[model samples]
Target: MERKNLVIVGGGSTYTLGIIMSLIEEKENFPLQNLTFYDTDADRQEKIAKATEILLSEHYPELESFSYTTDKAAAFADIDAAFVQIRTGGLAMRELDEQIPLQHGVVGQETCGAGGMAYGLRSIKDMIDLVNDIRYYSRDAWILNYTNPAAIVGLALKREFPDDLRILNICDMPIAIMKSYADLLEKDVWELVPEYFGLNHFGWFSKLLDKAGNDLTDEIKDKIINGDFLPTDKEIANDESWIQTFRQARQMLIDFPEFLPNTYLQYYLYPDDLAKKESPDNTRARQVINGREKRVHEHCDQIIQQGTAKDIDVEADIHGVYMIRAAASLLFNLKETFVVMVENQGVISNLPADALVEVPALLTNHGPKAFSVGEIPVFYKGLIENQHAYERLVVEAYYENSYNKLLQALTLNRTIVSAPKAKAILDDLIEANKDYWPALK
Candidate 1:
């Protein structure tokens, strides 16, 4: 078997560490020839690079690894797979992440609505640069992007890159929630296959069934509404307000009875409530970010520090491991039927030809063959239309540097206030992200 070279952009990112750890644990199944880490920040990347080398050496000594500069010619050379997880700006801009949406009285999430548009504007140019670099260095390499504003990035790649360049955008929110749901149901997650669609974190599970063909949505819904479900973890549950958000959304689900909504849907589905100044403080976005994001950063810091001290634990808590497993099963083991995002190409029957829809797919050595989702609910279709338009505008704004298109994308976001407020926020965000973003007029 030929060895594969995996290149990780944004090497210092905690998510990258998680993926590396996952790969190490599954070393026997997917042995790597070489691992290369690339990041523009030398000091931060150096710390993670050293720590990763020490950790991998102690755990999986057979694989070779190195970390290098972000220079395209050096970092991307001869890569087989590239994992991208770059943040356009640093934690210094976190205030913008929180404040901008609060200014509009919305839920104020870091990766949705106004904040996400801001992020998209900044990230698009960098992502394109990296993508172009991959094509320049290794034209055949697969680019697995786990960036925020995933729908926009995916759209940009589809429009700009060659069809066979192999770009797949992913988010772990679905998998994370699915595991929690599986634990609540007392069933192995693998046994519960889900049929879901919509954009990234904003998606809903359309269908869920056990391997034996039993519908568990009702049972899960019952548990959620009754507040009988325990928190996924005590740390996450510590914030009482956050727990109530779940309870409130569960109530909404009971009322609708048509779909099971994600946590993020509250921002869109209840925009008035989420965006009202007097909208009785439910779980604010900061609470969730603090509870989840803070812990993740802490974990990464610990991993780097501990690994540097020779206390190496190369264990990864990443959903990408499951994706790799599914890919391997489909390609090597010849198993069929997994949910994946691929080109529409009549896969969804009704969705636009260029729209990237999530549906059941059959994976072979050639790649994924997406199956049709047929007709989705009217509400979902409406939501998809809004989101898809915003995403397309974002890509256009980035690729073309059209400020008007960027404003349109921001204004189109359900959580954004209106055209005027969107314009104000865009101005502020552009200034904040000047270093990362392309020059905009």
Candidate 2:
């Protein structure tokens, strides 16, 4: 078996710890030849790199190499797989993530609405730079991008780096939700085989069936509608009010029989309503930044404080498993269905060919073959059409450096007040993200 050289771009991330742990747990299936960590923040990367080395050395000593570096060229060189989970700007910009969307009366949240758009702007340049580096150094390496504003980032990379065969963008939200549903219904995820379709965060469970061929949509719908489901303890749900909002959305799904709503749709569909509700007393982002993010940072601080610290026990988290599976399927020519973002390519008959759609795809050495998703509900078509336009405009704006396209992306978002309001918010975002974004002056 050929050894896999895995390079994690945002290796210092708390999320990375889980991915490393998962890889270790599944070492028998996917053995890694070497592991490397790269982050712009040397101090932070050093901590995770050290910790990971300690963990891997104690357990999987056969691993060929372990290195952490700030140099982009050195980090990406000869890498077979790259997992990207970078937040272009730190949490200091999170206030902007909230306020900007609220300015447009959009449900202001961290990763889903206008805030995500803002974050996307900041990330595009850096993501492109990283991808370009991989292409330059490791021409055959696959880039598994799990970065935020996933749709925009995926689309941007597809458009800009069309010839690059190595990039695949993924998100854990849908997968995580599906796993929760599976656990609730007492079935393995593989057995539940779902037919899901739509854009990034805004997607639906079109069909869900067990291995025995029993349809479970109605049961799942009932649970969602009646609010009978319990929040996962792993999820930081400190806000009872947010929980109630979820319940309300569930009620809407029940009342409106045609479409099943995703948790994120509430942000766009009822922006003004959710914004007026106070910020959740506890948000996942806050919990993560305060708890895991802080701990990771403190661990780094300790390494710096002591001049050097031994590698601590670390494990690959499951978050990056989807990417690993995709790569394995492609490399070994295994036939497997994985969720991927690609050009509609007629997969969804109703969507435009150019529009990027998230749907199940068959992976093989030849690459991803997007499977067709039969006609979607009319309501979902409308939502996808509206959001697809915004996503395309964002990519156009970034690539062409067009202010008009940028404004169009903002205007298409359901949260914008009007053309004038959209332009105002666009100006603010442009200014706020000036450092990270290309000159849109």
Candidate 3:
């Protein structure tokens, strides 16, 4: 029952409210001594911080202190753990990430194909700087990074901070997927234990077991393959793009029933079909800006205007809850099993030892002890190798500013196999991301 101090790095984000609500909700289990919010944008952070102050006063006033600031040192100082959920260029850049690729008939996903590579390059330097700031302020502080394109970001962090075990790069997509599977099986998500393998947003569940150790993989697979696919989470279900993504996931499972496919695999496996359905003008970024972004900000404005959170529509979802619990596990030495991104080191016997792979690991005070995935079949191996190569080249391209390496990464990507298309996408992305990305030769 030891209380802890926490800081959420991206205080201005739409998702920050959810994390705050989740922290308040879990106060009984993971008590907080102090809570801090840090972001570069003072105006946006002020809005979120004001809403949070109202919510905390109305709900859990037990917190000893609550504050938000743009000062990195003030934010990082005395914090036991930091939840990093930053978007380097925000949604304006995400729109370009998705739109630019679709203009050339390739998948313009948030974390796959050319878009992911673009975002990944932009994210690398920022993440490295954030880590350095955290370490400088609190040498022992734990960093729970939930950044997008985690596959590339994770690899970059590993390379930069090889000996820093405190940084845990993670994504909530797998947990989101497991929630749907749990819903299908009529169980709580916590009761399910998944044995998974491969890269972030590019993995599969080999086995899923209930608390009693009953295998539920085949049952869930059957449900997905038989067109019983739908996200039980209301937030995701409300998004039409997410609904289509679920359907595509079902199609992937139907085509290859050996193991359950991650929903993102669809973007790579069926890029042509997905690309044809997309309107570059009305990309996923626009949907989010028009939908969740608009809704969250309006609710925050309402809470601020009313000076109370009693009737506000905002509430914590799985994304917030999962991150808080992961940090709690780290702080309290709970050793809970979670699927996190970590250096392979032979975890996946067939993949390169240095590759950053996502697998279930025991989250303890010392850091994650990754589970062994052993040798995968040739098909999955080939797919992961190609994706991993693309991820590696993106990281290399960022540091070296080698235009050719980026071209190679895009050409090898499953969503854009044509070298001509890859080159064109690269040039457009370079121009669009000139402000964020390093200049390439």
Candidate 4:
């Protein structure tokens, strides 16, 4: 196997360690010559880097080299690929994103509706910058982007680099759901191929085909409709908050039995339910800040204080292995099928040709070629059309810096439909995200 050099762009993120651990596990298949953690936050990355350094020395002594840096040139130079997982304003800003929306009686959550719209605007500039740097230093390096608000971010990237096939935008939510289905079927997820279509975070799986070409969609639908909402392999399913989120899928199934809805639909389809249940002060961000964020940092601190990675509580981010595997498939031309966001170009017959849609695609060294989604039901198409308009406007707002475009984007959102409500949420988000978001005219 050919070893490669890679960089983790947002290396300071708590998700970094897990990705590193996963790389170590995949050494035989996709070995790395060097792994660099690049982040602007020197102080934060340093803690995680120190822990990682000790982690390497203790276990994979033969692993040649690793380093951490804030230097852009050094970070991008001569890398085979880059894995980006940036959260622009950190969890502090996420607290505001969630809190601000809930204050106005809207769904206060990351990567959905009002909160996601705000976060998307902040992410565009950074992601564009990172991709530009990667292309400059390593023109052919594949960029596996796992950034949030993927619908907007994916659309923005397409606009900035229209022809750069190296950038692949993906979300792991569908992957996690597949894991649950795999567990239910007593088979691995890789053995199952899904027939799905729609915008990121808003899609429906109509079919699940196995390697032998048997259809498992009916079985899965029955299980879901009958209220057997299973546990997923990702971290989200393990949490109490997420468990409640998953349980709501039962109601969604009972309501729309034709297909299994993506978990995020709970926010869009049942807005009243979310608005009533969510806490303005004690939101998801607060839970994460007090739960995983605190624990991850505290564990890093322990590793730092002890000056050793031994007994460090960092778990392998199995959830992240999909990105690396996708990268490997591309670099080696292994031709793996995975769901990714891309310009539709007739992949979904009903949608505009240029819309950024998430569909299963064959990933190779040449980039992704999406499998055809002939067409969707009229009801689903109508819902997606509204979302596409919103996503497009967000990108326009970022590029044009038009205040009206931003307002229109928010108004199109199901969570903030009224022009007045849209303005209320937008103003609060603008005030909260002043430092990160672009100045709208």
Clashes of each: 2, 13, 0, 0
lDDT, model 2: 0.73
TM-score, structure 2 vs. true = 0.89
Q: Ten-residue segment with the worst summed lDDT in candidate 1? A: 277-286
In model 3, the runs with Cα more than 4 Å from the true position are: none
lDDT of 1 by residue, 1-441 (tens): 455787888887655556767777777666688888888887767656766776677677888666557677788898877878887775445546657666656555567787777776677777888898888989877777777767777777777774663676666666656666788788777687777776666777777789888889888877777764434532344567546556656766876777777667777777667556322132244454565555555555776666552443335653657655543543353455566567677665556777766665666556666656777777788888788788788877877778898899878888774898788878877777777777775
Give the runs in model 4 whose Cα sits over 4 Å from its true position.
304-313
lDDT of 4 at 248: 88
TM for candidate 3 is: 0.98
Among these predicted structures, which one has the highest TM-score?
A: 3
Full ranking by lDDT = 3, 4, 2, 1
Evaluated with lDDT, which candidate comes out highest? 3
The TM-scores, one per candidate, come to: 0.86, 0.89, 0.98, 0.96
**Which model is ahead, 1 or 3, in terms of TM-score?**
3
C-alpha-based local distance difference test score of model 3: 0.91
lDDT of 4 by residue, 173-244 (tens): 888888888877878888998988988999988889999999998887777776578657655656888778
Scored by CA lDDT, what does every candidate get? 0.69, 0.73, 0.91, 0.86
Residue 204 in candidate 2, Cα distance off native in Å: 0.5
lDDT of 2 at 433: 78
